[model samples]
Target: MNDLEELRDALHTPPGFTPRALDLDAVMTAGGRLRRRRRLATGAGAALAVAALLVGGGQMVGGGAVPDRPGDAPAAARPEVSTPGRPADMLGDPVPTGLPAGTGEYVLYGRTIDDDALPDTTFGMMLAVRGPAGDLTDRVIANEVVGPDTAPGFHAVQGANGPGEPTFGYYVGPATRITAKYSGRTVTAKQARWSADARVIFFWFAPTDGQLKMLTAYDADGKKLPAGHNVVGVG
Candidate 1:
């Protein structure tokens, strides 16, 4: 009791000291402001790091180290052929029926086949007509056949029907003989004409009449080809 009473007297307030109440609301507001500032600084640092990563990724893409995919390969080139022999406007005009001016009763018909695997390339222009005996007749005008390597172009069997008929053209290849059976008669390739570009051979032929049957192409060895090997037929 004596010691506690002495300590209390020593701790007594000095003269003119005033006691004041604490402001709890002001202290809480100041603490909240400090926490918000810390959170803002953390968010800004994270945003800057993400922006740097994106810029680095863009630079890597522009470095050209990426390999080309299969889809990015270039397309194959197309075959080259000569311009059409006849005028475009003269295609469907009717032929005169008589005299020196009259060629024949014919109409223009064109057929083209291009196959790289089979190595068969042909572009033919046929003058077709209905015969007096109710048969279909086809006369060759311009025929172009591409060869394998240094071989000559394709040739056609010449016919006996005069100038307007299909004639034989020239070609060089393993093929030695070409025969066509039409109207109960067999026609064979005769003469050959070299192309202006020298890449192909042209063959003219006489008019083929009656129900057209088949065209058989042969190598120099005279072997009958399989059903569709270099064989041309009416479809």
Candidate 2:
């Protein structure tokens, strides 16, 4: 053995020192406790990181952070677009049960409520959103008024008041494919189920992509559909 190994052996097996019997059970129990502690610490740290992400800025969406203020930085950290998929259950004060529309990174919950006696605003469509972090923000968008037969087509509904906030809206039609144009580039809008009715759908464009110059809806057959009476933007 080398010098270091020889020194370790001498210290471990010193003469005239009778070592206690090995306690395999005790050693295992201590190891288990240590492992449990490590697991708890790891879990706490993960929770803290998620909490910080939510508290630091209220605009994170689509699996990335959104800058709190404009000119801070463009939202390049976010995905190019949220892939359309089944909406996952989001954590909220009163977890929204309405038909949510979004990908894994973000979800949009909307419901048309009509109850004057309700504590919260109980009129028009109540729209709430949740970011990738899995908690719904306090912000909610509600239309003051909506008529019974009002079928507003694709329209610009800004989710929040800043420059880089998301602009989304609902559509009631037979469109299965929706596309929006910005800066002469056409981008497919991410869509999700808004209701049992296939015609009712929710869609949105990426943040900080600038206002959509035009939006077009297409049927499953790829044929362009005529804009509804309440179409928003250039049809």
Candidate 3:
């Protein structure tokens, strides 16, 4: 009905059209060939159009056609003070996970490593929580480090313990502990120990991927605690 549509239909028509009364196979073959040719032309035209758009788009973006307003204009679209030492996040959130079979029996909280860093936290932190009576494995990721749940504290940042203060992993909401350490002579990561309310279990490893040593608390009662034994005790 529209002029543009009518023009398109007219242009597609064969110039020397005829209503033949013979040679059925010949007519069919010719018609099929014409259809194929038309289809090829259409596909080539579409490809050319897409190529043109891509080139034009690259130019528009690269040429700096977009205005640069100082107030809100973006130069380039590129896409945490927890405590003095630990991360600090005040907003409340509940972490979720699918892990060891015993998961979901207890609730989880905190951020996943793949997620954008939570407020006042590291970019690649795996924070979590386990409900009461929940097994640690199914409750937490296979290799994630976790500390015992403690009462909420000011800002959710990892605690700042130093050589002078020698802080242990306790206070909660969000905090970081020396969950891992290098034990080899080279001082590379060979062992680690996450904190709990009970005795610490240090899993010593080797250059190879195998469990070499698992040191349990030698002085649970602190009877022979080395002068500055930084035992892993939690609240």
Please give the distance, in angstroms, between residue 166's alpha carbon in candidate 3 and its true position after superposition.
23
Q: By TM-score, who's the top model here? A: 2
- Report lDDT (CA) for all predictions: 0.35, 0.42, 0.25
Provide the clash count, candidate 1. Answer: 16
RMSD of 2: 24.5
Q: Write the candidate numbers in order of decreasing TM-score.
A: 2, 1, 3
RMSD in Å for all candidates: 38.7, 24.5, 28.8
Per-residue lDDT for 209 in model 2? 41
lDDT of 1 at 170: 38
**On residues 111-216, what C-alpha lDDT tens digit does candidate 2 reach at each position?**
3332322223222222334455554432233221223323535532333233434445556677788876767888776776555345556676566445665678
Per-candidate TM-scores read: 0.28, 0.43, 0.14
The parts of candidate 1 lying over 4 Å away from their true place are 1-164, 167-172, 197-199, 223-235
Worst 10 residues of 2 by lDDT: 33-42
Question: What is candidate 1's local distance difference test score?
Answer: 0.35
lDDT rank order: 2, 1, 3
Better of 1 and 2 by TM-score: 2
